[model samples]
Target chain A: MTIRYPNGKKYVPVRTSKSQKLKNPSFSNRGKSLEDELNESNDYYLSRGIAVIHKKPVPVQVVKVSYPARSAARITEAYFGTPSTTDYNGVWKGIYVDFEAKETKIKTSFPLNNIKEHQIQHMQNVTNAGGFAFLIIKFTTLERYFIVPFEMVERKWDRMKAGGRKSITLLEFENTSVEVQPGYIPRLDYLNAVETLMKLYDDKIER
Target chain B: MTIRYPNGKKYVPVRTSKSQKLKNPSFSNRGKSLEDELNESNDYYLSRGIAVIHKKPVPVQVVKVSYPARSAARITEAYFGTPSTTDYNGVWKGIYVDFEAKETKIKTSFPLNNIKEHQIQHMQNVTNAGGFAFLIIKFTTLERYFIVPFEMVERKWDRMKAGGRKSITLLEFENTSVEVQPGYIPRLDYLNAVETLMKLYDDKIER
Candidate 1:
């Protein structure tokens, strides 16, 4: 089944090789999507009282509905609505956490087009409010994940707007972004990186 | 038109009498529902950079969808899902804000059944994380609104669990909760009450 996004983009499923699955038979997220893994991570965080993050429901505009005499109301027609904000947001240790997760198959660079303009604006808003905002960049093919801070994103976005490089290089990611290793309970374990980000902010304040 | 909630409860729209509308002709929200007013207030806050709050979309589980030949994909089958968390939450002035808005025609007491068990749990999680959590209770018939802190609600909930009163009386509300007066730019200015709540917390820490 194919699910179309608000922009009419078809949701593509990431395929895992049989050999790769067999090689990592013990892991739970062998063939799972980034979104699914992140959700599982959130569940782990919630169950342990570590965080209260949640993914917002996909925005859909219901155009028509029919109520059967003895049954529940059935939605007859609906269209996906463009998201005005990022997917995940919640509080962690008295600090606000907001971030967007995007999986890219490209290994050399992470494209700027993966995030929308308004989404960047929303992240900027969160950061301006003293909240921690970042991007969870999942290199699906490379089996790597990095938590790219919004400040870095904003700088690149500004440069891109001025006709500079259209994407951030892997070298840049290695140098600036905090890498998160995949694990068992919390599939992604991105909060460790978040803690690092928080410390960086604290150090800046102290300075 | 009626929209059923995930629990199969039909959404009842607040009806405004013609005389009442005439009496409050100058107000933009004369015939508006509490949800509408709250959304407008959030918009006002967002535009002014005061805060970034948003009402989560109604949760719907899409069972089936059809991709038309030329037009957009249409959801042919879906069911409303019970909300796992409160309707609204966001960041405000470096603080995390979480809340649920509820309206009642009954002026004597605010029914406890309006909030669910998991929702209370969600608010408790927010408070435990050192985030701000509250309820925007609108007494439609009495034209009164209150910002009821989670602490007050928690006390009442525990009392109810032990076979005490299931509802909070208007007298109790007036004594404990912060009253929010309706206005033009922002229909219900509950953030001012939230500021008061933050001050209360600061004072407690200082003490």
Candidate 2:
């Protein structure tokens, strides 16, 4: 990288071009995407007596507020707040549950990069605290959803740090995951998956 | 309320005045009012895994938006959307729960006018579907919080509609209420009250 001071002094890069992008890749919802579908599913769950889980609203932090005469306050400067937890967390049947729902079109494997460091840490904390923690990874192109345990994720995460594979393959997903049936009334009746999760939690408790 | 169009004209009471007065009540957090304390208590509840409940953000429907820059969109006009449900709802100990949290300062009684018609209907729906529905009414002047059952609310609502008293007396609040100890976390840890609620719901299910 090169830089110049106000005096017009310039410097050139002595750095390696090892592929790190500064710009954030936008996840645009081109038309109605899986997020929209999940929103509908959430609404369906709320309407029926199945579950009550809501996607947290995009967090906004107001820095400068302007309360003009006879007008609503205008926020001039603000930035997105980093969520300390997963995108969703709720209780069902006395079980404290937390998870991130994701979808990608890649066919062969799911990239470990799709999961963030903070998210992995959050999942670890929840699991350690005797709560159910997992991910809803949906292969968009393949029309498949898998419930992958965070315990499995932790091992893979350590390997990736040690220069191992940077992703979880399709085979691993098929073998170590449970499928959630998407229905009409309660849409993604995830409580069923939660039932399976409860058994795992109970077994852990017993152990 | 009277208004003039482009031409000189007058009208009856406007539909918005009551809503505006209800919403923008000058909430003076003077030396920490009951509302302020409860809000803080709710925050305490959320952080400690005691209960999960939040005041719903006001619903705003944007009519026209101006995109003036890449990252800024200015809303031109927005109206309040009719909220069908109560202010708060969540799960507690494997039991489905929903409730409206309200505050009143009248020393004599809780005004029935403080309870809305649609809210009563929503509570009825929640109760019918095997959920614990309730109200957490804080008498500000008295510094007392009461857990009022939805069944009692339903009966009171019936009386109000039939041209009875516009509110319930302090005696009524005393007779059919569960007192909650005001605390820092889980402000109204109505679980003590939930025990009473659970019995009622469980008996109905057993029948």
Candidate 3:
């Protein structure tokens, strides 16, 4: 299947051979990491004065260490830190933007466990403040992606807690969202999706 | 020495115990640590819903750990991670807030090195998007606290880069900032200082 909208030349991100084993089956275009692609796309957007977006820095936690000999102290103990906030947050054309990018192999639906309680709350707060908040779900197995707003997610999440299915089925997501074309510079051209969400929610403040 | 602020309660947080020696003079609360006081103040502000502020969890790079059969996993090695953002970022009332709190025992001034290049960029981006951005400075030797806006900071920083003095002295900060009277509940009632800054900036978005 071919994408109709964006046709820009993109640089494919190379995947570290170590991580290829964990990637979703059928998705092999792992040339550049998501962070690098997003950074490049953000620079492109920024220089043109089109929109401003940034990828939040990685979160790291360090523990005990030793400096006995005359050499650099070695990190001996540490773990990944949980970000209390989203991975990316910024303003685009006068609108507050907050989003998280995720890759999954499941072809039928996305799992709810990928979303955390604190992140849900953060998105809720963002939407409550009249900000544009959503997630970019990349279905690596199906070679597809969907951009869903908080409102749709809130509905599904509430129903799930009320004894419904734990995950959002592929059918439901496809029926609700518009497809986005993946480009070399921007792995997922999500602004097109944001445009859709903004239209639905009313775009009085957006330029 | 005691000073009353007409609110019918003590303004300064008294020393709980004056006996033990604090090895780190940067923390000059005598018997109390700066982190403790900051936590106490954040809690007070949070409970009243006046503001929601939190310290960004510190970044650590863990390298090795040993599992002890009789107890928890022992962290054997770790090191600090270079954080690209500020120490704290959150919302106060309706205005998005970003800040860094620091203490210096030196009597002359606080070192500019305390503010990292990435952190300055983050603050600049935050403020450019129309949010409240500043740093809280605690000079332990002088027993003074000052809230300096990022705009002023960036200006001074640019000058320093052009072969000027490396830092803003205590005298310069005192002349430019509001001295936040300490409190029992929220040790440093920062929002009060924020309120003053808001009036100066004349931003209508308030709590």
CA lDDT, candidate 1, residue B71: 88
Q: How far in Å is the alpha carbon of B67 misplaced in model 2?
A: 9.4
Better of 1 and 2 by lDDT: 1
User: Which one wins by TM-score: 2 or 3?
Assistant: 3
For each candidate in turn, the TM-score is 0.86, 0.61, 0.73
lDDT of 2 by residue, B1-207 (tens): 557666675544433576444433443322455556656765665466554445544444444555776766555544445566776654344344567877787777888888888889777766665556788887766667788888887888898788877887878877887778766454456667757755743453231
Which of 1 and 3 is ahead in TM-score? Answer: 1
Q: Write the per-residue lDDT of candidate 3 for residues A69-97, one digit (tens) a residue.
A: 88777666555657766777665544567
Consecutive 10-residue window with the lowest summed lDDT within model 2 chain B: B22-31
DockQ for each of the predicted structures, in order?
A: 0.44, 0.07, 0.21
Residue A175 lDDT, candidate 3, scale 0-100: 83
Give the CAPRI class of candidate 2.
incorrect
Q: Poorest 10 consecutive residues of model 1 chain B by lDDT?
A: B198-207
How many clashes in each candidate?
0, 1, 19
Residue A95 in candidate 3 has what lDDT? 59
Q: Fnat for model 3?
A: 0.18
True contacts kept of each: 0.67, 0.03, 0.18
Kindly report which residue pairs in candidate 2 clash with one another. B45-B186
lDDT of 1 by residue, A1-207 (tens): 889889999987543576665433344556688888999999999999988999999988998899999998888888888888999999887788899999887889999999899999999888776677989998877888999888898899999999999999999999988999898887888989978866764332121
The alpha-carbon lDDT assigned to residue A37 of candidate 1 equals: 90
